[model samples]
Target: MVPEPEFRSYYGQPIIKGPLWHEPHMPAYLYLGGLSGASSLLAAGCELTGRDRLAAPAKIAAAAAGTAGAAFLVAELGRPERFLNMLRVFKTTSPMSVGSWILAAQSGLAAVAAGSALTGLLPSIGKAAGLATGITGPMMATYTAVLVADTAVPSWHTGHRELPFLFAGSALASAGAVAMVAAPHREAGPARRMAMVGAAMETVAGEVLERRLGLLAEPYREGSAGRLMRAARVLTVTGGALAAVSGLTRWRTPSVLSAAALTAGSLCVRFGVLRAGRASAADPKYTVVPQRERIDARERNRAHGR
Candidate 1:
């Protein structure tokens, strides 16, 4: 039997550099974008169901969150003006460019909807705008997963299939949390249900991601990333249970507590993912070893020519 090929990097260093994104910027952007995307969809649903009270606040929150996320993304680029430069090009292959366009559309429509709601003007136009976000909203929620997974990071790349589902679930949870907290008890039923379903999706997706990654998932099990992930699991489970019960009991305290926990858990998930990617990228073994094994397998296949 042929032995596994050995590999080494320059001076025993990582083969590829990790992302340069810093704290409170990239992660915050991710959280806010996800919140905005899902909230916009929820607002549209509430509007369709004639829950004006819920729709108004949800629309406003979606606009605010999307705008805030955009600002954070610009800050990460080192200058607010640099964001404008991205508009100069439209590249279908670039996730960043596609995301920028989607964000702009989602934020613009949400802001218009919220602004019209405030002035009690252009009711039909506002509804149209809210409906428009429904198209871009899901894309906004899930595209970030592709953006990150497209990178060279071991953890991120290997889990590409599951990341979109994970992010989508997290987005739903965040949106539901905001809606539950901000909307009145009478109108918060859908929000609670959404939170419960989202929590389940996130938990299941996370488990699948870890299991499929095998050794690549080590980053999520050790160090600060591990701590955050563990805390996220606890918080997600607790929040989901509370949300499930909150619907039946209709208790304000349980609803609020559940919302808070779910929101915090979503943030932890984003941060944990970022940290795990960094950890995976920083370790030379993750990059070198997997690639060497892949090369060996390819060579074996070619030699046999079966």
Candidate 2:
């Protein structure tokens, strides 16, 4: 005879509530933040290489995106005024606090870089600001993964090791897309390489995460999250390949298309990840049973040893 399965509740509830905000706002913010960070890096690289024209636009875009995304993030918080509470205390264990500081620094540096670029009167100072922005930009792009992973959400928290790489890849692709749209071929080549690197990293990280997650992976492999993940994978891979080839060829149209595809793919990834987190949080099975079993197993092992 077999024993009956035990059912558990999540916080004494069968189903979890969804996040208050809609998908577009949060996911769009994620995309914009990444785009802004990567743009800063590109700007710094361009300035170093004497590509002032490319650097100028990249700086402006980075500032705009960082500012806008930060605003959106503040708005998303239930108590907008309490957003400052995040900065009041710094906890290394809390990704939210860390991310807030990173974004704050990224935004400030990007603003300085953009201002200098526009005025042209502070070249040396602007160069310094751009350099600082570049250094923090990658962290801004990738830290969101840490933020999501630090949560109790099964899908995201379980994939903590890979989320940073995934986000970094998406950020790089986004920057590449903007460069392809704005810069000349000579200046855009490096952006293309960055995009390719980002795309490859995102793909590999996502794949490893999916494989390692086991039951938790269902959120990413099924339903709306699954659909979005599939789309992201295809677009990122195909667009990256095209961008890589375009470096050797003078085909401007294909390059532009590839950039667009990569940008779209990155957006898809953000939304998919957000949805997967929500899904993981919503299901009692994801939250309760596994944890309970782990605790029980640990207790049993201790008792057996005694």
Candidate 3:
């Protein structure tokens, strides 16, 4: 087995700088964006399948979430022009730019869909708008992962492959929570199943990531990030299990509580991811050790002439 890389630093000071995003703004943006994206897709699917009750509420929720998240994003940027400037150029290479475009389309389509539902005007147009959101919604939900993981932050960069799926699951769970709370039990049954599936996917993905990462995963196991992640896991699992039980027993109270837990857990997961990125960037070891190991392995490969 290869030896662990030793990382030296100045009195254990951080090598890389932490993210400058502030609380409630960045995390809230992430949560609401994901929730809106997933809800949009849910609305589209429900409408296509003749679940008008669930579809109507989901469209409204999607519009509200998207509009609120847009506000939070602008607040985080600290200026409206800063966000507006993002639309000046479309770059396929920049996740931020791509996300902006996606959000623009998502928010507009969601609004139109919601408005049509409310005003009973141009019903076919509303259905078309909802269908369009189904395309943009998943992109909005997952691109934030690319935005975060593309940074120099160690935890995020190292976990890039898993982050998108993690965010997708969180989005799905949040959407399910909204559906369960807003729709009738019969209409919400599919949402409960969605919540359970999303929870399982998120939990399993997290486990696989931490297990594969070994030492690099330390930031997720200690400090504030660790605490948030632990809470997310517990809440997500408990909520998912309760939702599953409710489906079997047809109980209303458990379903409601499960929705609340799942919503909270989804938010916690976003916060945990953000904190982990900060923690990883704050520690020099996270920046140095694994990279040094990769360099050492490459050098050894050259020496072997194979």
Candidate 4:
């Protein structure tokens, strides 16, 4: 066979640049963000349904996760003092900055809601905070899509539209899973329903993104990312079905198993998304060709207008 052409990096160094932060930092951030967002949603649902006992844990978890995740993000920035720089300006084009603000607001609201639950004081204020958190929680759950999409990574940027939905769904399932584990069956009904809804949304969004993202989608369907995402889909679907059916019959074992499955599936989605982004960034073709084509297309359009 003919010898394969040798590939050389600039200055004979590596072509792919790994992320600045360690894997633990990034992966933990993903898990924490999902957990926090889902917890807020669960808390809100519990409050609405008069399940105060369930709301207590959900609120506390949301607050803790939100605050801790924000701390990790600041730490990952490498210079703790420079964290304020993120809030110095508001630019719609900068997803990082916007997401930071969202996270900040979410964390604050969650803290208040949690504190109120713990103190058993200011019930009205707690309700208000819970409502506010419910609004911000969804944004926290899904804005990572916009954050990743804004990057130069091909797989992530291409899947931007669907990523938000995927994250939101995963967050919902994760929160539901936690509630199912902690609350009584009657109190956990809303959690099960939320999990089913989230799972369904995640599966649909992932399928659509995989089908519509063209070549960039390859990363999510061909290697480790593919394996994780496929597993996520299967587990989510199966678990969600069980959750839905559990409502019809009060089978504690099946309900518990389904909740566990949903939690695992949600974690897989986060890991798979991160892996797909890394894979997209590592491939030169993914980074260069699409951008070059876009530039060419823009130039052609300008010339035609002239």
Candidate 5:
């Protein structure tokens, strides 16, 4: 067998720098932003379906998570003003710019809905605001995936096609879990169903990402990142199964357990994705191999044409 090509960078340094986002804060924000975004949509849907009991909890979850996620994002930036600066200009080419606007609108609408639901003030306005989130809510949930994928991080950039679905599914699971935990059991059937669906989507998309990426997927399937992904998979599958059971039997215990598992699993997915990106960026092999493969493929195509 031909000896494997050795990979190295200048002085063994990485070809590209990893993300500057700090741990806990960035991942926490990701989790919360997703929860808030998806919950807003769920709240609006519940209201339309006349499930006020379920809608109330969804509103509260959306509002609380949105505010908390904003705080975490600000923390990651080390200043709230830094976040506001991004809002000064919106650019179609910039995922961050678009995401900032989406976050602002989703958060504001969620807060208004929660406030109105809690205080019974401006009910009409609150209802309108809640409904409006459906336009921005999905963007809020999956825009982060775009933001990260736009970067040079190999793991994230390579998985762009699936990242949005992964994030969207995770967001749905998180929001649904909260509703399952907070809303009355009988009234939370939609939430349970949503959680199960989200879990299935996340799990399947993740598997596809790993399989399709081949060697590039090593970071996501090894070391701490691998451990976290495995844990997320277990929790998500178990939670989804439990959610289905709880939905049919109306078992409160199973409902609560399912909620806990789904939330934890969603958080794990965010953390694992970030870790995988970091690992891939810190190594030269991941970047070099992909470039070499593309070059080889192009050369082969040219030769064939000749």
Candidate 6:
């Protein structure tokens, strides 16, 4: 049998530097952006269905989340102009550039929708703006996943196939939970359904990611990140189940609990992912071992072809 290869790097230093994104800022931005993105979609759907009660909360949530996320992002960037600078040119190849544009569009559109909803003026303009957000909403929610996966971080890069789904699920779950808590129970049926679907999608995608990533997945299941991830799972599952029960009973107690749990769980997912990426980048084994294994596999494939 072939012996297992030892993992190391030059002078025991990390093969790649860990990301500098600090606590509360980057992760908060991620969570809020997801919430905003999905809320925009929910608002648009509710508006089309003439569910004005539900649409009001969703519009407000979308506007608030987007604005807050931008503030956090700006804080992380250390300068307001740094964000504005990104808008100077549209680089199709750069996820950062494209993401900046998406954020701008969604934020502006959501703000307009919320303004119209609140002021009771230009209802037509509000409807048009809310509808426009549907186009940018999904992009806002999942673009961050693509941006991170494009990097060399083992934990983030390896799960590229499933990360987008994970982020999208997280976004929808957060938005649905917000709507469930903010809107009337009768008008919140669709929100409850969305919460369940989103929770299930996030859970399944997370499982698939863990199974596919062998060694790289350790970061997500070990240390501080692991603790957070475990908590997230418990909260998400419980919240999703309770959402169904709440829908059946139409009780305030279960609905509030479910909303709180789902929202917290979504936040945990973002923080845990950032921590996992940092952990993977800090360890040379995460970078080197997978590369060597891929190389060995490629050589074997070539031999078989010959």
Q: Candidate 3, overall lDDT?
A: 0.90
lDDT of 6 by residue, 91-209 (tens): 99999999999999999999999999999999999999999998899899999999999999999999999899989988999999999999998999989988999999988888888
The TM-scores of all predictions, comma-separated, are 0.95, 0.89, 0.96, 0.85, 0.98, 0.98
| 100-172: candidate 5 lDDT, tens digit per residue | 9999999998999999999999999999998988777888999999999999999999999999999999999
Candidate 2 global CA lDDT score = 0.85
Work out candidate 4's RMSD over C-alphas.
3.8
Give, for candidate 1, the lowest lDDT window spanning 10 residues.
4-13
Q: Is candidate 1 or candidate 2 better by TM-score?
A: 1
Candidate 3 lDDT over 1-306, as tens digits, reads 999666679998888889999887999999999999999989999988999989998999999999999999999999999999999999999999999999899999999999999999999999999999999999999999999999999999989888888888888888888888788887788788888888888888778778877777888888988998889899999999988887876668988888888989998988988988898999898888888789999999999995
Clashing pairs in 6: none
Question: Model 1: per-residue lDDT, tens digit, 1-306?
Answer: 999766566787777899899998999999999999999989989888999999998899899999999999998999977888887788999998888888889989999999998898999999999989888888889889999999999999999999999999999998998899899987898888889988999999999998988889999889999998888888988999999888887579999999999999999999999999999999898987777778999999999994
**In model 6, how large is the Cα lDDT of residue 71?**
99
The predicted structure with the larger TM-score, 2 or 3, is 3
> For residues 132-203, what per-residue lDDT tens digits would candidate 4 score against the true structure?
888888888878877877776778877888988888888888887777767777667887888888889989
CA lDDT, candidate 3, residue 1: 100
Better of 3 and 6 by lDDT: 6
Clashing pairs in 3: none
- Candidate 6 vs. true structure, TM-score: 0.98
Comparing 2 with 4 on lDDT, the higher-scoring candidate is 2
Give the RMSD in angstroms, all C-alphas superposed, for model 6: 1.2
